[model samples]
Target: MGRSRGGYSTKIHVSVDGLGNPLELRITGGEKSDITQGEELIEGWQRKDTKVIGDKGYDADKLIEKIGEAQAVIPPKRNRKTQRHYDKHLYKERHLIECFFHKLKQYRHLFSRFDKLARNFLSFLYLVSALFWLK
Candidate 1:
């Protein structure tokens, strides 16, 4: 879930490569925690050890543990006085996700909450993602 002028906009979280190609995507409520959706997206999908990257929103300890060999490059959230560590260089790769969202929002079905059911919305989301991957 990401904050926007429309308030908390529902995000269809996705994992992509350097080219912004979709590998997996999961729809999350506008107010849901990013860490809550992390493992769910990767379960049964990871083919090998992978590297996960995100902003401070995915900085939960449990989510990091679940990812195993896949390193999390999540930055520490501000206002957390406690000092923490992350891979600064690797985290730069998170731009891929930003690029992916930019492309996704270009689609009408994806940018707006038109479908009544989550399943239907997810179906459209998947269809769009498939098309992105095909190109």
Candidate 2:
């Protein structure tokens, strides 16, 4: 989602790997924090073999520490009170996730939240991802 007169718009909670491929997508209330949705987005098998990269917004101590075998490559937020170590070079590669979102939203079905149910919306997003692979 993009910025608007109403303030920052909707946040698409996309979970991507170190290479920036979308593994999961979740729609939340526009005001939600990226870190708040991180765990739910990265749970189970998909997270078993990956190094997750995200910006400072996902700098929660809990999430940074607990992603199963996957490493949370998120840097510490500016105001964080502790000395946290993160891989800067790895974080740079995170732009792939951004590009994925940009491409994902190009599909008309995913540009807006038209479905009333979360499952339906998720299915549309998956369809959008599938269509991208078809190109």
Candidate 3:
């Protein structure tokens, strides 16, 4: 968990397939950089056709290189001097992960983080995710 003016918070990173089904999920402190978690999220990804699409927050050279065979569609950071090529068409699909977060917020406790322990919070997250998967 991370502390900011809003108090303790967390960031949930997730990946989805072309169909918008989640392939991976990671929970990190709200203060943690999204680019830092980017590589870990694809650690064991085996699908060659997989392409990771993320917003500017996830823009990092290490992540782009780490993705290896799988494509990365992260937009360059505003501070970058030279822009990198990204698939605009595919990057638009990154909204699927946003929609997932919107659905996750429906669970009141999750939205507020009433659970003190990260493990417990993660358990509920998985449970809620399972519900989404069932749908």
Best-matching candidate per TM-score: 3
Candidate 2, TM-score vs. the true structure? 0.76
Candidate 2 residue lDDT tens string, 1-135? 334567545677887654556677777656667778887876773355577777887788788667757766788878878968988887888888878988876776667666656677678888877666666
- What is the TM-score ranking, best to worst? 3, 1, 2
The lowest-lDDT stretch of 10 consecutive residues in candidate 2 is: 1-10
TM-score of each: 0.81, 0.76, 0.90
- The lDDT of each candidate is 0.76, 0.72, 0.82
lDDT of 1: 0.76
Please give, for residues 1-135, the per-residue lDDT of candidate 1 as tens digits.
345676646767787876889888788777777778877866754334677777787777777677677766778788777757888988888888898888888988767777757788889888888888789
In terms of lDDT, which candidate is strongest? 3
Tell me how many clashing residue pairs each candidate has.
Answer: 0, 0, 0
Candidate 3 lDDT by residue in tens digits, 1-135: 667898888888887766667778788888888887887788876357888788898888888888888888888988998899998888888788888888888999999899878888888888888887889
Kindly state the number of residue pairs that clash in model 3.
Answer: 0
